[model samples]
Target: MSATAQALRLWRRAEEDDAWRLLRADNAPFAVAVLAEHLGGDDRRVDADELAEAIDADLDEMRSYGHDLPLNARGYLTAWRTAGLIARRASEGARGETYELTVDALAALRFLDERESPRHAATASRLASLSMQLTQLAIDTDPQAARRLERLRSERDRINAQIASIERGDADDALTGPRALERLRELLSQASEVPDDFSRVRAVFEELSSTLRAKILESDATQRAVLDDVFRGVDLIGDSDAGRSFSAFSSLVLDPALGSAFEEDIRQVLERDFARELTVTQRRRLRGFLDELKIRTAEVHDVITVFARGLRRYVQSQDYQRDRVLRTKLLSAMATAHAAAQTTKPYTPVGIDLELTSVASSSVGALRLHDPSEYDAAADITTHETAAVDWEMLRAFARETEIDFSELTANVNDVLTASELPSVGDILDAHPATQGVASVVGLLSLASEYGTRGDEVEQLTWITPDGIPSSALVSTHRFTERIP
Candidate 1:
């Protein structure tokens, strides 16, 4: 299935079972559920164009957050958005699709994760109460009141962290990422007596939340104004003001006189720094994907370079070992997988070993010494397989073209008119560089057919020059628009 469609399928699966209810409560869960609701059924069969647009918009939204929002606030928003539960809507005119709250989004609110579903409703209500209490604390001004406010704000953070952990899987590193306040709360509550771990957890959360909250509230109007802009798209605009005076705010909030000195000097300061760097949720994770792509590209390139060096050394040394060769090959394959990601895998080696014929996993074996035909066929197979990989690489390179040509859009459009083969010129028209580029486009079309779950996006055409074909050149775009 296409990414959107597959996501839609996942959402439906969750919703039909009443699981989607938990998603709408937060941004990440909302994104995932939103995708499902927007593209459910026929939508799960979203066209390539829509997928392209959704991804672009998501990236754009994230960029805005990073440049404008405070690091701490941005981190929280990112968690909420990347949960991938929000429904994406296709915007009219120049705009593409956007995330809109939907039925599935509501389901996200009722999120009953595999473990947290039972407490979903109860936890949500408690969270609301804690949020209110923190607000009250923020307004209070007495010296004793400041300490109590810090305690309450820390509690509120713990609750928010717990909700976050439930929406995202445990692999999300909720403990390190967001202070694991909620988990720590449960940990403290469950213990018979106050253990070192429990005390440590509370101390850590209290310092982290209070320190960050104070910095944020004390932030100058310029910073606060930027903060307001960061959360402009999101509805949660907590008391914001331009040119707001915050000098009255005590620096002691972060560098305190009353709180734990050791905790303040070492842990609290470090914790504040970490919290500030945390990425918040945006309307989409499009920017995250782009950053990931850049990182992944760098990693893949390094691996490939290492492989080339290894191959050169091994070939020169003539110290041939099957295990070593296979290991190199495996690393090379993994590099390709990382680079292409969803693209068709380049090669599936079938290693043969005479001694270990019983082994299902292929091993190294020389060709039958006397069979010429078998040798020729095997050589042809190797050539074919090798050629396919090169083609895929070229396609990937070309696709990193001037624009991120949406695979989703291409997949949705290409196969609408099956049996009508696009001409050489027609294919070339979409991309006009060289024969190599043309070949890549062809492979891309064919790849989309196999990669996508359904045949709607798969198109095949027949072009007979002298014999006189029906349609001279029907581009994939035209194919999608055609009523026939």
Candidate 2:
């Protein structure tokens, strides 16, 4: 059969499948809606407990509306998985299986939730998109250089005319009122879909990685050939349509200057009269949509980076050489076995039984225990008499007294009271070191509590009792007098 006929047959079978029927079921809409609301964000996987928590309120509402909803979310998820609408897989290092909406299920959910009448701005934005896509297609497929050059010239002329209009302070070309709202709506829709795009891109990278790993293990190809195939697969993933789109999206979203400009533009747009007409929920959504885009883009970039690192390690370690060696050994062993089987008297395999004893068990009877009676309980006790403490030595050991921080604080207050605004040096000069370096530390601590005025520096010098000079460099301290 032709590939087209096979595809058509498969499509027809899918249309009549139990999964498709489940999607069309009466309760499917509610179930899908709940799933989308919960697992639609950066988190693509939902555990049983999380799924239950997310849909409990929605299920209750449905029950109140006289619709029967699934009480056990885990069972509901299992049933969907059995029907091929959802996928359940063991989560890495996690106890329970994680559930994710299969591609088909997501498509079906999207179809069901699609807007009957899309936002007003969607029509014009779609037309612009279509025009852009057509232009790209022409540039890609058309062989006429003159026609492409003409198109470019026309575009440049249009841009020049717009610039001239702006130079003349013309207000006619500016977006406003309903038109501005439509554009804003279009932007919001695009931004909201970015997370979904990221999820799809990440899924593709994971699938590619799995395929490369399986090929490396099972293929009987040469080491160099295997390595080449792996590298080619990596390149294809990085250069594929989805990969290219994600690269462009991430570049734009991750640009520091562009991100800043986007935020500033959003702020200015939100202040306009047309923006004021939007509902609070719509306004909030627009405000946070760019932030969500940056976050999702970062996550996708991180996942791609990790996958690339693992791929590089696999290639650098020459793992394919080991796989090729293992394959050769297996082939050689199989050939030897086949040759032996064709002999007049084939080597008969026989099992041999040998008794073995562990060293611990063998030495068990040889171990001798010390007689308990030989070890007297009183003989085991050894005690030393406590020595009497000398009061003079104890007093000498406790010679160092604790420095009082309160005293340091009071002294700083006194100096600042007299000088109005004293630097750290001034405070230290007013209070001589009674506790050596510790006293200076206390003064600096008190100065820090009062706060510094600026980046001005002050040097404090003090002499220890041993006549060693010590100095401290401190920022200019602003001392405020205590009110009480």
Candidate 3:
């Protein structure tokens, strides 16, 4: 057990000890009457004699029992003729001065005296109090540290409240029943009979049984609002479409990526009620979404690299200003061609269009180094211009920047060469929804091609609702596209 746990156990053992029971003769020297008399009080010089007479024998006996010199009783008396139990200060004033318990000692004894509950509770209460005091002390010593401690204390209180609620079964508490609950045991036995999906079933059942484990922690509104502002700067996503979007604001958190954090947060909430009322299809769907998420992560990473390169190009060059008109003309023409091409029914290409559309280049124009006149110094401008550099010079610069030529530039040639990337069809084939189909090129492009090639685009490309016939869209009233 932890030190806190051990101390709690000892405190509880002591709380269960009642003063009346301790005073019983059968309790002997360890009895309350003997222990009580050892407490002394500041009763002045006259009452000192009486207090001394009453406690002297008990003190001597306790000292004989190996409690030795300057025990609490001796110290109390030396300090004040009176040192006694704070609770009995009234009618037993004289007796009180004769022998009384210290606050900590009283707390220990009270913990031992409990018959109503575990003594650990009293210990916990006292420990919490002491801990708060120590916390306050540290906060006083460091002003900046004080602010963080306040946040922690608020978090601690929230957690404590949640724990209390669970213990009381007030909110969404699920764990219930006696040790070795018979119902749970029987259910497990039945679940084991079907061996194929044991792990999944057991996990669901555990989530169902133990979902009350969220620690019931909560922060205050003021702190909550402050945190709201801080995290607002973070695009924390929950169950909405943003959560599913790879581009969600939360995905950009530097400290800890919020996409993973969101998945984990929602998983905790759902895990609590996993098997409670969940359908088999729902379970499968959840698992599928998680699997899809993992696969999509790699796709997102690749897309990030492509975009990063685009950004660097934009930042380094005069892109839009130089290429805007040409790009617009090309994009418009391409869109028209694509729109018509998508409808090309009988001519639908079944291959992996492993090509990034000529769209980006259409906007930028061709890349080439040329001089119409052979005598022109186009190649030697580097020697005359202020801001001048070329590709070969760049390669040399890279070699110079690298600390170790042998290690850093060892495979630079291979890295510089571009490799063919995996195709779109390959990616879609890996997904569960479309995995059964070995060929996806036709499935995805069929509608678009039909639209372009067929005489009636609307009739060819529009989707009728599930279970409804295409005949439903025959009416002129409900179509997005009306062109024949």
Give Cα-based local distance difference scores for all models: 0.40, 0.69, 0.39
lDDT of 3 by residue, 240-308 (tens): 142344345324432256556756854654465334454555444443443444443443344344433
Per-residue C-alpha lDDT of model 2 across residues 254-366, encoded as one tens digit per residue:
88999889889889999998998788877887787778787777767776777666765575456756876888899898898888778635546546665677545456678
Q: Which candidate do you rate higher for TM-score, 2 or 3?
A: 2
Worst 10 residues of 1 by lDDT: 235-244
Residue 456, model 1, lDDT = 35
What does each candidate score in C-alpha RMSD?
27.7, 23.5, 36.0
Please give the clash total of every predicted structure, in order. 59, 0, 42
The lDDT leader among the candidates is 2
Instruction: Please provide, for model 1 over 334-442, each residue's C-alpha lDDT reduced to its tens digit, 9 standing for 90 to 100.
Output: 8978887676554655475457556354544643347667645444334343343577788767544312334423533444344354433344345442323323344
